[model samples]
Target chain A: MFKGKKIIVFGDRDGVPGPAIAACMKAAGAEVVLTVTECFV
Target chain B: MYDPVIKACSHVLIHTPSFVRYGSKPSREIDDSTTPVLPAIETHLRSFEEAVEYPPNQVFIGNLHPDRLNGIEQPWYRHPVEDASRYGAYGEIMPEEEFLGLMKLADDFDLMWIEKESAPMIKKSLQAHPFWNNSDLGKIDAAVEMARIHDKIENQGSLPLYCHGRIVGCMHRHHEKDDALKAQVLMENLMAKASGALALTHLLKKSDIRADEIDLLLNCSEEAVGDRYNRGGGGLAKAIGEMCGCVSATGCDIKAFCVGPIYALVHAAGLVKSGLFNKVVVVGGGSMAKLGMKFKGHLAKGMPILEDVLGGLAFLVTGDDGESPSIRMDSIGKHDIGSGSSQQNIMESLVLKPLDRMGKKITDVDRYAVELQNPEVTVPAGSGNVPLTNYRMIGALAVLRREMNREGIDRFVLEHGMPGFSPTQGHIPAAVPFLGHAIDAIKRGEMNNAMFVARGSLFLGRMTQLSDGLSFLIEKNPGRKAPN
Candidate 1:
């Protein structure tokens, strides 16, 4: 469903991290330009 | 800058055939008049050799990896590991006598009393064990006379302790009339603590972390340790920590039936990430009440009882080392109160929802660790292959999500699923059993990521009709911080 999409992700250490979202998006044919996983707390 | 990684895990087992009669179902049947006594139980009890040689038990103690079970012949009990040792890479398989001595060592108020004749055997065994010394064995009191022990059992309500079908010791009642403080319950609680302490001690050794450095301890065993004033109001964590010399650690019990360990793991991770503790340890002891839970079925099938051992496990969670696999805190999935209780609904909530949030599909996870109850123990009881059932369900979900067609489900499962290898200790089998292997495999670069999923039946407590579940992912550490 994410085919041909350009995505940027901000992930949380306590929730979902950015690399995981990037992996998912990439699996769905998206181009992930940036990914960051932060501790929001 | 705080990230928690699983540093090490240790799995230990105690072969306690004598305790099988004390398990919930067996005791209930014993007390009831309608059902006949299980005639085949005593004859069917596996010996120490069989217990150590059993494939699943070997897997539980880390003598053999779970993947090795695939190549071994089915009806795994028939094909024993050649020259299996009492100790494994992760932990040891302790015999009943040493565990009895351990029960005495774990006892503070002199509740457990070993017969005078058997004292030397226990003392020598404990003395030779890798983890203990003479000073620790000093906690074992001089043996009680057979007359006094018989008195305690005959009229004082003490539970008899056995080894090799002999009366080796007895546990005295804590209170005269309180059922919660009775000898039987106390025995169960002590077994949990003693076995749990062994696992914790091993975890300290495996992780190269000192006992006092364990700043927090979590007791996730299913045993309830409390007095009559508050049955199940317990302090297993501190009890276990005290036995293991985790002097700086004080903690409490967490209960969610089979899902207790996973809940404790998440809590431990949170504690470490929040800087509440530098190192947190989660330990679960084997349930004496779960022993021989499926003995009747095994007996009916003319097979030896497979549920003869008590399983214990411990995991160390510390600030990320930039080498060990890091728990994906962001990818945690929980079963909500509103989530439907159907198989598909539960899978979607626990398996797919977290993956969806992470922008991944079912195929992305290298492996999925779920209920790992040994199929040999469960199959005869009509419970089916639990872990495989979970894998197929996830595969089915992939089909539903259009990740693959229906025919590809088997291929998906084969690539991502592992055979069930955990002992049938209720909480012991629920996904967490794979932690030790997961850490090793990821570090060895054999796999990228694995998801641990735990499901509990809330109805077992009779509080509600709802089912419960939780999941989290563990992947190879990226070894870099995210940009602010």
Candidate 2:
């Protein structure tokens, strides 16, 4: 739905849904840049 | 004005039996009500699933489950997923068979069923998906059996799990059923995870967005996730992201009881507006604790069990485009720690103060979406109508503010408030559901501004007596492009 929209995403490694937010942004075709403070995995 | 606009929102529902017995409140509600209806209405979820609307914007999931009233399908009946009019912006009500497949995908989250038993069952049970490879599952079965067999025998309690009328596997209680870290809790948590993943998947699918494009994810549900040492809520966002192909995503969990979604929305909006992030998504998985929550009430009412659904929502807030409704940052409402707990106090802070700050009246908002639990589901349970109660409070606030006369309160409510259409899934009925409708209405010139109000009971956690609330306005696009 967000076609051609310039969407920059930010996520936290600490939160449960942060990576979901980041990955969804990318999947939505947003130009994403993920910043992981710490990797939980 | 705010930089972040609601790019899209998708709602998804799934019917699973996990909530029927394991959900504490629902199980208790069933036991407490004299006329408990067990197994009689298990098929009702499938029937009701046919009626709920998909995306353009829909409100009520409607409590009329035909199968409960007449044990078979009527010639006129059509499932929501099949019908074009019934489905909402988010997605259609996924059938039970598909949802069972998802539970398998989410199994690694401390959930395990007997492989020799469930494996063959799942082969026939699970719907087709990329993750449903029997070969891949064989590896998990081999590894899990060696470890799980040690816990399956004498001391552990094994509860056989069922799905779509077939035995899936025995859910061995590694500890007591009440043990928060073991069987029951683990099942509930994993169901929520799978449900959330399904929603996120649909949201991405409906929005035509790519999973890898997601930058930030926030899980607003209050699910606890951890090992034996530290049982807590964490990393669900990333796990869901990974499940949906969001390889580059990072995430966090936001906990505020029912108000968590609103908090996540505000935080996401701020990040987008502040140029810290552009595409921000907020998602809340369905609550296992809430499923079958009012089954007994529905049974007494001779209606279908309406609480069998798992509610999941995913929405993207991004820098504004000329077409989408944008979030108004300046008028955001918050109930501070010192804010006294009272109906008037909450209404004042959430409704009037924000409007006052925005230099608008109570009547300025075209509609208010708050705690919109369907009366059909709640009234039978003696919970009364939650959305109606909320509307009355707002109408009473309007009367107090002299926005309208007390005598016209009903009329005001009729005009400004909507009938409760959401399932009683706590946070699912909160403000977020309205975003889909408000966006549609605004685009159609039906309304210039709409407010999304959410309130959470902090007292539920026993940590505080204060009630939490969050409110924000979504206005017409203003027909302007965002500046670089």
Interface RMSD for all numbered candidates? 16.4, 16.6
Q: Write the per-residue lDDT of candidate 1 for residues B1-484, one digit (tens) a residue.
A: 6358999999999999888888877788777847565455778888988999988888887778888998999899899999999888888889987888888889988889999888988888887887776455765658989899999999999988888888988998989999998998999999999999989888888888889988889999989898888989979999999888889988989998888999999999988888788889999998998888878788889998888899999999888888889988887889887764445666798989999998998999999998888888888876677787678888999999999999998888778888998888889998988888888889999999999998776655656655678899999987776232
* TM-score of chain B alone in model 2: 0.84
DockQ of each model vs. true complex: 0.02, 0.01
lDDT of every predicted structure (CA atoms)? 0.84, 0.67
Local accuracy of candidate 2 as per-residue lDDT tens digits, B1-484: 3457888887777766544665666566456767654555564443433434321113432222211212223222222324444344556565555565566667763455644555554554443443344424442243234245445633576544666565545455554534656766776677778878877876786675688788989888758876566677387888788778787678888888788889999999998888877677788888887777776676666665667677888888888778888898886998876555445665788888989998999988888888767666777776676666678888888899888899988887778887665777778888677677677778889889889888876655656445578999999888775566
At residue B109, candidate 2 shows an lDDT of 36
Span of 10 residues, lowest total lDDT, candidate 1 chain B: B458-467
Q: What residue pairs clash in candidate 1, if any at all?
A: A15-B330, A16-B330, A24-B359
For all predicted structures, in order, the TM-scores are 0.90, 0.78
TM-score of each candidate's B chain against the true B chain: 0.97, 0.84
